[model samples]
Target chain A: MALKGWKELPIGGVIDEPGKSREFKTGNWRVLRPVVNLDKCTHCMLCWLYCPDMAIEITVNEKGKPQMLGFNYDYCKGCGLCADVCPVHVIDMKPETEFLKD
Target chain B: MLTNIDLKKAQAVTGAEAVANAMRQIEPHVVAAYPITPQTPIVEYFAKFVADGVVRTEMIPVESEHSAMSAVVGAASAGARAMTATSANGLALMHEIVYIAASLRLPIVMPVVNRALSGPINIHCDHSDAMAERDSGWIQLYAESNQEAYDLTILAVKLAENENVRLPVMVNLDGFIISHGVEPVEFLPDEKVKEFIGELKPVYPLLDTEHPVTYGPLDLYDYYFEHKRQQIEAMRYARKVFPKVAEEFYAISGRKYDFVEPYRMEDAEYVMVALGSTNSTIKYVVDWMREEGHKVGLLKIWMFRPFPKEQVQQYLNGRKAVVVLDRSTSFGAEAPLYEAVKSALYEASARPQMGSYVYGLGGRDILPEHIRQAFEDAIEGNLLADEQRYLGLRE
Candidate 1:
């Protein structure tokens, strides 16, 4: 049994499904994830705006390369808001249905 | 299923009593209210419910409408299903906190017994009080009759509490006309109402000791607008959630309401826009006018805050002209509601020529004939010259 208020992994790290909980994986699941092409991308953060769970983060480099951040699947329910709002077609919602592969 | 519901034999009650009965059914955790005309009976019945143990809710007798709203906001933030009722000047008094409740995303339900705001005070019904705060971040539902008033009160709670629509809602019932007028209102069982509402647990409520977060944060000019923008987003979410909530309510309660109710508008050459109780009278006139081969219609706006701009745009796309009836005046300027309808029409791809007429100030009785005249006038001479047309004032 887990210690009371203790024995946890990193926040937004891998989370164990609670005992007897049903797995609810559906939709276009992306495993490797969509990487942004910064030269063609505008940081409109429409992906960030539409994210229901606030999982997507946008970071900039010294050269001002705006990159679409990766997913924290522990926190992400796999809702493809990030893909839907990718105005410049930079971030693609590649299927991660393999995560549920036995 | 609900073969148990006896719609006919339900006791005849006023709008206030219907609201009172609905409140009793929900059994709120706390009720903070101040007495005002027409709105008094709802709080009175709630107080009696507390006394009789019909509802295990705490009845807080606040000194003013400000404190009434303040108390409910505090209670609601603390994870209690808080509620209150006020009218006219009282709702106006609770003004500042109304925006606060919605910003904090507190699912507080307030029944605004529609009354005229005072200057030379007259005790009467008008949409002036509710319409004054039309831009406030709260879902607004205007009821045409006592039954809708009662049923909408219950529906307001469900809509306001939904996760997608975690915002406050005010159910506006025109004072005296509906608040005092008796009509047979079906009373749903408390268990049935409870089942429909499910549980009252708010997401990350203020009272939770395990995980805590600050609410109603003080934002500077930089953040304040963004916070309000988020509120606008929430209101948009609410617009979508409202119909779903009402559909669920209808499944259980056998009552229904559309945000914007249209009457005989399919082939309307001319139409009238109205809110609150005036719609009831306008509907009657529309039906009568249609019988005489006139293509007149009425669009009654129930949900005002998340103004159904697109919905109204779609409905009024091909109309020749629309006469918006404003219950409250904007003094030297155009009526506030008339301005909203005009603005909404402006956004439409092809909007009909819309005109506004200010009517029914300080509880003046608006007759069906006045509605008929407005329809006829809009159709004829295009009497769109005056931005303000008084409804029932002696010339």
Candidate 2:
């Protein structure tokens, strides 16, 4: 991103626009990524409710009912509280190295 | 519009109560402060105002000194006109947040009652506490009396909230001496204070739902320095913007102040520089020595943080002798005010033979005879740059 001069930038590093936090990706900081199996998943939304960063993405399927789509890797600091909160025990925390090795 | 039929009456109150009265008059949106000695009375008095329904300020009785500052920072960020008060240990505890308050450009008006920083635990008057945060980017105004304390607290709010100078301001009054001692302080009426304070008009406040802004955001190496550069520029702008705010304050109260106040220095051959409540005692010495035909005067540092460089140089330049007194010792340093005075006169055409005195620490009584000795030393050329003297300490 192009940087603004001190005078050009707003005072106190306050991001003036909403959702500007999305620009700064935190997924890189994640060592453990939460992965879920859609086959056994009950879509209880507990993991969605428990995610600290709001990294769990929710959307509507063909039936138009809200369903847990997947993790929004753009954020998702990989705290693993989301996987722990899932009652069905289908979600798992995997090492980032597994994906990087691919 | 100055309202109320009865106003401008000087009330007999201590510096703490006077400041609380000013806070009452300003009626800020929030006051998040923890109680501490000397400074506790300020919040207590203001709390009374809150209880009586005199003002509708959201007074947050914070758990700790750190939380007190944090609460104000949060409130200020949310577009509320916020203020806080603290003393020695309390001010020290809020150290981390103090810098954040300035860097974040929150216009928090805090009145600090100057007390001795603990070291074996002593609670009395000294500049040690406020001096610790001298470089914290807040504009520090030291008051010599209750009236100035009252007036400066009001001026600080106006100066801090200025668009060009969105920095926190610390108004200092001497602990016990000024904080507890009663003096007649002229106060502005509530409507007049409201008119003068006007509105807070915070920049991109979090409370504004339409304009969502993220405060205290993370900026890495790419932009951290530049953000600090903005704080630097804002402080420099405050030096220029202060007089305009003081001008507005003067119009209502007929009281005006400057960075440095020179008392009887017009034709003086010997002069001394000092700050806080000590100036009141120093002035008495200035008056006494004037009668004896020795041309002696005092340059009281009204504003400490900015250091009032030019005015200090302008006042002390070409004088035969200059004595700088600090209530707080820098431990190994040459002392904060003394070092500043010397640096100010570094580029001047002529320099005065200087003397540095570290006096009145931990609330030691500064006697006239002791003040007389400093001036007499200046007269006799006994003062040396390297040899720093201590008043009231038998060594």
Candidate 3:
């Protein structure tokens, strides 16, 4: 969203939109990004619990089994917390510029 | 919609008690009080009111003044009518969140008993506490008597809750002098007060689960300045909304209130300017000086924040000279009220010769004679514009 002028902003700095936090794509300024392999042997969900930004995505399949998904880059600040917390060593830190060309 | 208006009978009550009575009538949704000297009896009485089932309010006995303010901030953010009362040190402790309360535009009403900020450890009447928060973005109203202490507190709810003026308000009374001394204060009908204040229509309330919103979110450089500017505009808009609220109050109470109450300024060449309870002393002196044929009047300022600069200039414009009495000083700078009056009259085509006096620090006695001397100096042109003369201070 475009930044508003002083008069255009709402009174009292109230951000009325509940889920606008996703609009802040913090991955741009990060030096490196965390890449994860969802095809790992085990889905321990350890990285999901430790990711401070809630960037580690997890989904449930139709069989009621937890499946690990890739890192959500929208809010990930490239903190490498998810890479550090992954037990299977499937997640790695790579340069954010490497994925920029894609 | 205020009708069948009848002024209630007057009863003598201490200033603190009067404030409590006003708060009870308003019946705020929440009150977080941590009592200090001169501001204790106010919340104590309100707490009793709550205990006795007189008014159903969630009165929190907070551990500290900081948490007291924090509690009310949370309550008011959740779209409740919230209030608190505090004194010198208490206000200092609440200072950080006090700014947050105003910046967040919560229409919280607070009663501030003016007391000396102590290093020498004094519990007495002075404007130091309120003066320190001059730029904190709260609308400040100084009460001269118990009647004003009662009336303005009630009026402040309407003033604060006005859609255009959704900022916190501080209704101030002198410590001990008004807070403890008994005075004949007229009370409004409880239902009339509730009717006048209407309801709290909070904007973007945090408690609205159907439409969730953020309060006090970090804006950083991207939007912090804009939010601050928005709060400044809210303060500015208060001046425009003040009179409309005052008019509505007049309809219900039959009392007219203005930003500055001028006591007999017509055709007067010399004027005395002051705030808080000292106006009563200056008024008595003004009467005495008029009987002896000195054309002197008193301009008792009621609203200090969003300072009534234009109204002050209009009143002091044609005067030959004027003396401004400040109950608190800025240590090195000209006193707050005096400095404000000087700047307000700076652009006047016929500016009055200004005499600044700092008096009654630490609740020192300000007799009528001190006010008479100030007026005499103004009339005789014996005042030095550069000097801040002390009144009743033992050098």
Candidate 4:
């Protein structure tokens, strides 16, 4: 539906509050975290199968036995598909907000 | 009669009416449009205003959405406030000129009534129509409610016309939900809208006779792709200018909105991610679930073209489970929204488990319980969507 009339936008300043020391780069914080459970994990590759970013990598043990995969968190935005599709309920969500205050 | 309301007065109106009023206030020099479902009444009302001398803008009746967008692109390049509206297949048809409008930095504002993209033809809302043109270079803004549709239209004009961001902007509204539904809308005074917009100043106008700059000059591969690279830089400016513009809008209107809205998400453990009308329903469900002590929230994506990557990464960072509600299917691949959110989370170190549900395809009404079911699915580790589970399908 349509909203009410137009609102005026003030030009020239980026900071909203008057006395804020820390300028926040809102994009720096991660929203979603994935944790892997080595016990319940199956070597079945479903998490790697559907990963759009190819963030998950499957590793094998020294004895060549199938082992659980690991994820690259550098570019991950915390969308938990790897955790979601893990046949074994091996991965869980850990939010990133616990550390970042802003 | 022109009904004058408070500058800060907030109310809900149909998407069509909201867009029409926004156009009236913007005072476009030319409004070229072809009547299409959902977007038809918007132009119709604007036509009436022009006929009755209520609005002093030239309302040009065009044969197609392509022509409508083309006419506005040309007019805008020549330094005129130009705007139009279209829906579904009509937007798809205007695909050719849409990219050109952005590449040339033509600040034309168009309201696209989000409808299902066709094959086995459907004429209702989903998001396939808008999502289909995601890469068209236009700054995409998805509106959940009517008020957002209207306010975003104004913001679209302001943002698109900004010196830093001279790309075209498309304010998307769901077909029936916002287009047909009417509510009490406070129409801003023409003087106030003019005041807000100020005078139109074209930086490198096409019509400048004294300092003539070539319009659409042919370039070889050497400079051709670089021109497109400049367009990318302008889009980066669009991402930054969106929140800056929103902050200014909040200052005057007292209504604040972000590129992506996070609702009751401070301590939310379970979240549903979607866009358009579905967000409204999701919000209601989130509120209900919240009262019952279930930690649930909703993230309504308003800006899609620039993708608001940084903002989304921050807002959705700490949730336990994220259920991406994809309204449109990506055929054999995962849904588009689902893919974007999933990728963003993957980039962040701290991310939650992401589950996807392909619901509300072909105009199906996604309900509150369906969202609850998705939440349950996320919690119980039911990742794959069940074929039989449809939200508001007609039996």
Candidate 5:
């Protein structure tokens, strides 16, 4: 997108476009990525609730039951907040380089 | 929702009460304020209206002035008509958020009951508090009397809410002199005021769930300068928008207002430029001087934030000399009003000889005689070499 001049900006510094946060790839700043162990997951959705970046997604099962879909790294900075808040140690923060090597 | 208003009745009340009456008539959506000396009565009176159901305003009695300003910013950003009042140290406390509100362009209206800023601390009439925030990018209107205090408060809401100039506005009234002193004030009826101010149509409200928005984001070198340029453009827009709004207000009230009010400046040889309640005494002194065959007049600055450069130059260009009366000292530097008026005149084709006098610091009393002497000194051009002339200060 072309950069707007000073006069073209919205009044009062208001960012009018919805979901413009998606344009900023904060995932580039992530050093560690969360690896979720789906087998031992309790489906408590605590990590989904605690994810500061709203990276965690929840999906519905065949019977319309809710299930954890782990994290989406598009906008997440991988702060390990979800790993810290997990009840059963279902998630672990792994170095991004190590995950890439795997 | 414009109701039929009666403009004939007048009530005797203090400036604070007058402003409160205006607030009750306008009936803003939110008012978040912390009480301080002199400004306390304004919010206190409005709070009673809230309690008594006279107005359906959500009054947030915040713990501190900072929080009060912050709450107003939040409310205003959410597309609500928000307002607050403060004085002296309270204004000092809300200093940070004051700039934020303006930069965010929330259109929050505030009444600043002017009082002296502290070192030893004073609770009297002075412009130190409002002067401290002169460069905060808010539109400032100074009131010389209780009636003006009430009128300007109502008008400030309309000015700030203007789509082209979506900046915060402050109405200043002298602390004890105007806030506490009782005087006769005429008010427009509630329905007429509602029609005059119109409705609050926010461009991009945070509360609009379907169309989301972000405010106060981190804009570094990439766009910070551009954003500041946008704010300046808005201020420029205010210079044009103010008169249009004032004209609409005049239609209802039959009282006309201008950015700078020139009193007897047409053929005067010397002029005195001042702000706030001091102009009243200066006008009286000018009349006395005129009777004595002295060609002197007074220029009262009703709007100080936009600075009214062209209007000021228009009135003072041909004058022999001009004296600027500043109630607040700039400490080590020249007084704020003095520096502003002097710089504004520098661009004129024919610049008048200018002098600065700093007076009434910490609520020092300024008598008519003191103003008379200032005008006389300006006419004589006696203090041309003096850096700063001190007025009414005991040696």
Candidate 6:
């Protein structure tokens, strides 16, 4: 969409549409990416609970048990909070360039 | 389209009471205020009205001026008609949020009882407090009398809430001089005032669940500049809309108003420019000087924020000399009002020789003799080499 002129913007810096923060794509600012080792993961969910950006996604298995699905890189800012809180040491902060090379 | 058939009778009251009465009639959704000298009575009166159920307003007696302004911003952003009152140091305390309120384009109406900014702890009438926030992007309307104070308070709400001018407004009255002095003020009936202001239509209220909106967000270089440009556009729009709003107000109250009130300017060679209550003294001096065969006049500024440059030039051009009286000093530079008047006539083909007189700082008394001396000095070209003079100061 073409950006409106300053005169066309709403008063008070109001964003008329709701839930549009998803469009910001803060992941572009990330220098590092979170990498998870599923086999070593204890399923403690501490990383999921402690993720500041809410970037950690949790999934369920066929037996109806919750499982960690690693970070959602689209919105993750790579702050390393999830890795810091992972007791099992399954999550590692890797440079985005290294991950892309692999 | 208003007729006097529903106009209410006049009452004797102080400027503070007049503003409080106007607020009660407007019945805004929220008024979050913290009191300081001179302005305290305004909020106190309004709070009593709220308590007595004379008006059903959510009166938040906030602990500090910062919180008071913050609450007003939040309420206004939520799409409610919100207001507050303050004076002097109280205004200084709320300086940060005051800028935010205007930048957010919230139509909050604040009654600023003008008092001297203190170091020696003076609590008296001066323009220092209002002058401090002159560049905060709020529309400023200075009242010269209690009647104008009452009238402008009502008009400020309409001006601020105008869709084209969605900016906060500060209705300024001189501390103690107008705020505490009792004068006769005619009021529009409650229904007429209600009808005149009409309904406040918020563009994108935060309370609207289905269409949620962000109030204030972090906008850096790319968007911040554009937003500020939008605010400038709104201020320009206000300059155009103010007269029309005043016209509507006149229809109701039979009292006419303008951005600049030029008294006896036509055929006058020397004129003095001033703002706030000092205009009354200048006008009196002008009358006395005229009777003595002096071609003198007074130009009173009612609207200061948008700085009606064109109107100023129109009245001041071709004059022999113009003297600007400022109640506050700019310290190392020219006084604020003087700077504005000089710049307004800088490029005029027939620019007048202008001088500045800084007077009434820290509530120093400005007698009619001081005004007479200012006019005489300007007429005789006895102004300081720098063209700035101090009035009523002991050597």
TM per candidate: 0.77, 0.85, 0.90, 0.75, 0.85, 0.91
lDDT of 2 by residue, A11-90 (tens): 98888888766677778899998999988888788998888888989987788777888899988989999888889888
Which fraction of the native contacts appears in each prediction?
0.00, 0.94, 0.92, 0.00, 0.77, 0.75
Tens-place lDDT per residue, model 1, B1-395, is 11323657688888899999989988889999999998998888889989998888999999999999999989987889999999999999999998788777789999999999987787798888997777778888888878788888888888888876688999999899889998777788888888887778776566776655555544445345555666777788888888898788878877666778888888997888888888888888998988999999988887887888877887887788889988887767888778877888877776687677777777788898888888888888466634567667888
- Summarize candidate 6's per-residue lDDT along B137-250 as a digit string, tens digits: 999999998889988999999999998899999999999999999877877789999999999998787888888788788887657888899899999999999999999998
Candidate 4 is scored at a TM of 0.75
Model 5, position B90: C-alpha lDDT score: 95
Q: Give the alpha carbon lDDT tens digit for every residue of A1-102 in model 4.
A: 222111221111111233332222222345867778767777787887777765676777899876556776654556788888877788888777664574
| Native contacts recovered by model 1 | 0.00
**Backbone steric clashes in candidate 2, count:** 0
Per-residue lDDT for B243 in model 6? 98
Winner by DockQ between candidate 2 and candidate 1: 2
The DockQ figures for the candidates are: 0.01, 0.65, 0.70, 0.01, 0.54, 0.61
Give the alpha carbon lDDT tens digit for every residue of B294-341 in model 4.
Answer: 888988898888988887888788778888887777777778888888
Measured by TM-score, how close is model 5 to the native structure?
Answer: 0.85
Please give the range of 10 consecutive residues that has the lowest summed lDDT in model 4 chain B: B1-10
Off by over 4 Å in 2: A25-102, B1-8
Clashing pairs in 5: none
Any runs in candidate 6 off by more than 4 Å, and if so which?
A1-4, A35-49, A57-71, A82-102, B1-9
Q: Which is better, 1 or 6, measured by TM-score?
A: 6
- What docking grade does candidate 5 earn? medium
* The best candidate in terms of TM-score: 6
By summed lDDT, which 10 consecutive residues of candidate 1 chain A come out lowest? Answer: A5-14
With a 3 Å backbone cut-off (N, CA, C), the pairs that clash in candidate 3 are none
**Candidate-wise lDDT, in order:** 0.78, 0.89, 0.89, 0.76, 0.88, 0.90
> How many pairs of residues collide in each model?
5, 0, 0, 36, 0, 0
